[model samples]
Target chain A: SQQGEEDPQALSIQEGENATMNCSYKTSINNLQWYRQNSGRGLVHLILIRSNEREKHSGRLRVTLDTSKKSSSLLITASRAADTASYFCATVKGDSSYKLIFGSGTRLLVRP
Target chain B: DTAVSQTPKYLVTQMGNDKSIKCEQNLGHDTMYWYKQDSKKFLKIMFSYNNKELIINETVPNRFSPKSPDKAHLNLHINSLELGDSAVYFCASSQDSQPQHFGDGTRLSIL
Candidate 1:
């Protein structure tokens, strides 16, 4: 069974526009992580937000986690054509940190 | 230097054959994992090893075996491959519960 489900299966926007993707999970998690994957390539870790943390930022990327709602959001500010990729949200359950339950992923396209 | 690397970027084999994919990490991480990505791009965990000890094993078939000789290397061997076994396999490593570093993935096609 999938633990995380991402909203907006696909999103297309201009280069300067911001891209936001939301993810919702079923059970409690110890931490949530966001990753970016280019076509035909592997995933790259973007950012991670712990259960006790509300928000985290890395350069132009921002991640917010709402534990009460069991949801999280990834925001790419001032997106660029190079930012075009698939974004996935993964959760580490409170029971085990060794396994990561990944979402279906949201594909974002930034048009120049 | 590559952080996590997998050999044979692409593999095409016939059904009922045996094949292996090798993975190595230079980050000196204590934990390593193997994941499979289907055509839909949905990634799932197959196995995990910590310090050469199997820690997590999903509902994968017995034909798929993962061997970790050391903390930095984990290899996957599949016997009697089926058509449904075609998928991209990724190797990842992490320190404790931190973010994972992934390889470029090996695309396996069973004919």
Candidate 2:
């Protein structure tokens, strides 16, 4: 099983600015996913970038995956106060079962 | 309507007691998972079920058991709970190649 570890356990940023969080995994992965969890709430899926894909974008969310480095980055452009949450990176291996192994997480505080 | 929902958002139990958390997903998804969020807010997968078939079972203790009566419902039962069992438990569901949808979560406190 592959696990992802995020950098900068916590982050504080101003609204309207872009926030970048990086995640590095141990082994090869079939896909990498990003999830956001608000205070005292369950995690909500944000985006997913496959191993073969180098980059993916969804509105203000951008995910880049580098297979060689076994790392991935998630960027939120023009972040808003609503974006304040703990972001986690999850990896899914190539096995038939696509179970996810989650990372510690990056707590992003968007100070408005 | 919420896609995924868990019962008793908050559970307070004493040690050596048995408790269960119920989860249901109206999204008609075939896969459901149970995750444990520790004090540090680290989410870890405990178990997963696909259409009532056990798929992923992590290194969780034997005292914790997951029961999937059907594809839409997966319930967790803990026997002789300990202090270490206290944490936020989340239930999630997903379709093939789709993102996961999580329930609000159940905050279990064992005293």
Candidate 3:
């Protein structure tokens, strides 16, 4: 099993500015996923980046995975107030094959 | 229709009591999972069931049991709950290689 740990536990930014969060895992992963959760709500899957891919994008969200660093970063472009949420990175180990481990998450607050 | 639904969005109970949270997924996924989010917002996997069979148990106490009557339903039952058991419990389901779809979660407040 792999453990994903997110940095910058809390981040505050203006609506137009970009918001970036990073995650690092302990072991090799088959895939890494990012998720978002609004206040007191369940998690919503955002994006998944496979180990072989270096970057992936969906609409305003972009994710980059660096296998050498064992790290991944998620960037939200032109963030809006509605984008305020807790973001988490989860990793599925290449060996474990079944379970996905979640990180402690980074809380982002986008100012209107 | 909601893909995944969890009943009793909020649960308030006393210590030493037994409680259960029900979850159902209409997506026809093969795997269902239970995750606990603590005050720090740390989500930890407690249990996972695949096609009505227990597949993943993550060192959680035996007092916390997950029962899957069928592939679509996975219920969590806690016996003799303690104050530390207070947290938000999320139910999720997914098929192989698919992202997990989560329910709104059941907030358990132990008094």
Candidate 4:
């Protein structure tokens, strides 16, 4: 079963714009991760935020986690055409389980 | 070097035929996994192996089998393929239970 649900199934923006995607999960998790997939290819690890941490940043990517609300969000600042891809949020529920439940994903298209 | 890799990036087979997708990881991770993504883009976990031992097995069909030879490779074999089985299969590996690294995926088509 899928634990995370991303809002705005599709997003389109011009270059130098910012793209924000939201994800909500059903259960408590140890950490949440964001991944990027280009076309039908493999996934690239973007960022990960533990449950105890409220926010993290890497390069132009910003991730926030709200364990109380069971939600998380990914923000891409100054998005570029190369940033066009599908972004998925995954949740690691229990430490013992060690399985990630992925969301349906948000498709972001950047127009150059 | 590629961390996780899978053979036959694209697979096409007819119904009732058997096929296998092989995967190998060079990250020296103890855990490996297989995930299936349907046409709807819903990704689901199929199996996970740690050191050639099955650790996580979702409620997948018996026809879908996962084999982990040693700790460096895990292969998926499907028996009597069906149209519903057509999807992109991904192989992934991770250190302990940390973040997983995925392969390029195999786009399987069943006719």
Candidate with top DockQ is 1
Which residue window of length 10 is worst by lDDT in model 1 chain B?
B92-101
lDDT tens digits, residues A76-107, model 4? Answer: 99999999999999998775556989999999
Q: Which 10 residues in a row give candidate 2 chain B its minimum summed lDDT?
A: B92-101
In model 1, residue pairs whose N, Cα or C atoms come closer than 3 Å (at least 3 residues apart or on different chains), thus clashing, are none
lDDT of 3 at B108: 97
> Which digits, one per residue and each the tens of the lDDT, describe model 4 over residues B1-111?
988999999999999999999999999999999999999788899999998899999999999999987899999999999999999999999988788999999999999
Assess candidate 3 and give its TM-score to the true structure. 0.97
Ranking by TM-score: 1, 4, 3, 2
Model 2 residue A101 CA deviation (Å) reads: 0.7
TM-score of chain A of each: 0.98, 0.95, 0.96, 0.96
Q: Where does candidate 4 stray beyond 4 Å? A: A95-97
Q: Can you write out model 3's per-residue Cα lDDT over A2-56, one digit (the tens) per residue?
A: 3888988999999999999999999889999999999977899999999999999
Compose the digit string of candidate 2's lDDT tens values, residues B26-103. Answer: 999999999999999888889999889998899999999999999999999999999999999999999865788999
Q: Best-fitting candidate, measured by TM-score?
A: 1
Return the candidate ranking by DockQ, descending.
Answer: 1, 4, 3, 2
Task: Give me candidate 2's TM-score against the actual structure.
Answer: 0.97
**lDDT, candidate 1, B7-101, per-residue tens:** 99999999999999999999989999999999999999999999999999999999999999889999999999999999999999999888999
Cα lDDT listed for each candidate: 0.96, 0.92, 0.93, 0.94
Error of 3 at A1 (Å): 9.0
lDDT of 3: 0.93
Provide the DockQ value for model 1. Answer: 0.89
